[model samples]
Target: MRLSGRQIDCIRGGRGVFSGLDFEASSGEVLAVVGPNGSGKTSLLRLIAGLLVPAGGSVALEGGDAELTLPEQAHYLGHRDALKPALSVHENLSFWRDFLGGKTGDVGQCLAAVGLGHATHLPAAFLSAGQRRRLSIARLMVVRRPVWLLDEPTSALDTAGQALFVGVMRDHLAGGGIVIAATHAPLGIETRELRMGSAT
Candidate 1:
């Protein structure tokens, strides 16, 4: 599968963030979007995920599910963890699994994979930042999606948690999944860089 964005333009809050940007990533590839702050790295991801409507250009995924749009086939992990503080770890994952409605995996196994098995019943409000990130990672695993749009995926993750996430990403790629991550820190995996320039 190939995900490509051509001559893309992004505008936010009435200001131009970027324009004439082009990018492409195939299956089994990790495209790391890196740039200085305010360079539109996150904006690029949001455009591809269909969260923000682009002012110009287009994004298309070739060789993906024909019945679904790009966003439907993609998982967007944004700056916020997008968790419910009132729900337990397992409940949060369960909600996502049901809501996403795709090829599903075992939530318990996914939590264990992300090192959250022991906290399955714990409320999200009580979890630390790293744990919150881990739960978000677990959400990625429990629901199968081919395209992963991650913004600062390693944020709040400790050394071990970061390392564990590397394995999780590897597994996803091994299964022919594609990852597009916007990050300042190294992803701890081999990746092609898509460096954005300052906003126009």
Candidate 2:
């Protein structure tokens, strides 16, 4: 499916971060939202994810006119890793399996794919920054969401981690998945770029 935003606007703290932003992202393609900090990148993802209500305009899925709902056909991974600190890596992914409304991905495979297999039984609180980021990304592999909303997905990752994420993302898109990410550097993939700084 495709995600298209038309004249989308979002306000925070009574400030108009952006208004009338428009874009179309289809499966097998990626949209990169890039800008300096406070450029409203995250706000745009939240608007698309339905976590924040837009002050104007709309985000629709594919050819449908209805706005998407939170936890619907979209998977959002924010800058902060959202794993349960006390939960073991195994339990973390297991819980997300059912929560995401899709088939259960093999935790072992997911962990291995993220290069975190050895820490599968460890609590999230003890994982390193990069490791935690990988764990958060593992959530995406657990289910095939049509739209992936990732914020700084490569922030704490090294070259290998970045490579792994790029490979997984390519596979996802090959399977007709869409990705919209807010990033500072190249995500190892050439994407249609959207400069949000100009909107501010």
Candidate number with greatest TM-score? 1
- What's each prediction's TM-score? 0.99, 0.93
Residue-pair clashes per candidate: 0, 0
Candidate whose lDDT is highest = 1
lDDT for predicted candidate 2 compared with the true structure = 0.86
Each candidate: what lDDT?
A: 0.95, 0.86
- Superposition error at 90 for model 1 (Å): 0.7
lDDT of 1 by residue, 1-200 (tens): 99999999888999999999999999999999999999998888888888899999999999999999999999999989999999999999999999999899999999999998899999999999999999999999999999999999999999999999999999999999999999999999999999888877
In model 2, pairs of residues that clash are none
Clashing pairs in 1: none
At residue 121, candidate 1 shows an lDDT of 96
